[model samples]
Target: TPIKRAWIWHYQRDDRKIFIKIGNILNLNPSVVSRNFNKLERQGSDPDFYAKTSISERPRLITPHAE
Candidate 1:
């Protein structure tokens, strides 16, 4: 549910906003959220690996709207 809310806040298109939103919801420090986000970014760098992994196979927390 937290990730779901985080992803929704992500729609705001502001990293600071998303971080603050997630931090507030999780009661985490901004640094902690930044660290975790950094980890995700690192893992996501390898698109092929990420796509091949179970994480990529999980149902999306947010669905993209049809353009």
Candidate 2:
């Protein structure tokens, strides 16, 4: 779930537009995104740390296929 990892990175960085944009591109609700991040936080998982290590690779934009 690279996208989720990316979202966490952006969230930690307070990159509002980028994280929101990621959610929009995935057709995800903002609450869903926030909740997922919160859940990880409550579990004592440092998403930012993981994201920093894992997301060193640049992210590529991916267009969703039309239904």
Candidate 3:
């Protein structure tokens, strides 16, 4: 799926400190993309499969920056 690939691409990139405008590129809602990103984050925990979604531990790419 494009979403999964996009997420992997995100994970692979070193210059992904900022969030990608997936909504602008794919025309999907950012919320949906975020939800799936959370899912991907969980799935990243291979054997344990017990990934926790913490506000502090979330990937920087998905987190909103303070201005």
On the 0 to 100 scale, the lDDT of residue 20 in model 1 is 61
Model 2 earns a TM-score of 0.36
In candidate 1, stretches whose alpha carbon ends up further than 4 angstroms from where it belongs are 5-14, 42-67
Higher-ranked by TM-score: 1 or 3:
1
**TM-score, structure 3 vs. true:** 0.34
Candidate with better lDDT, 1 vs 3 = 1
**Model 2 global lDDT (CA atoms, 0 to 1):** 0.42
Q: Report how far residue 9 has shifted in candidate 2, in Å.
A: 1.5
Q: Is candidate 1 or candidate 2 better by lDDT?
A: 2
What does candidate 3's lDDT look like per residue over 24-48, in tens digits?
A: 4544455554655555555453322
TM-scores for all predictions: 0.43, 0.36, 0.34
- RMSD (Cα, Å) of model 1: 9.6
Which ten-residue region of model 3 has the weakest summed lDDT?
Answer: 58-67
Q: Sort by lDDT, best first.
A: 2, 1, 3
lDDT of each: 0.41, 0.42, 0.39
Q: Where in model 2 is the C-alpha error above 4 Å?
A: 1-19, 39-67
Name the lDDT value of residue 3 in candidate 2: 46
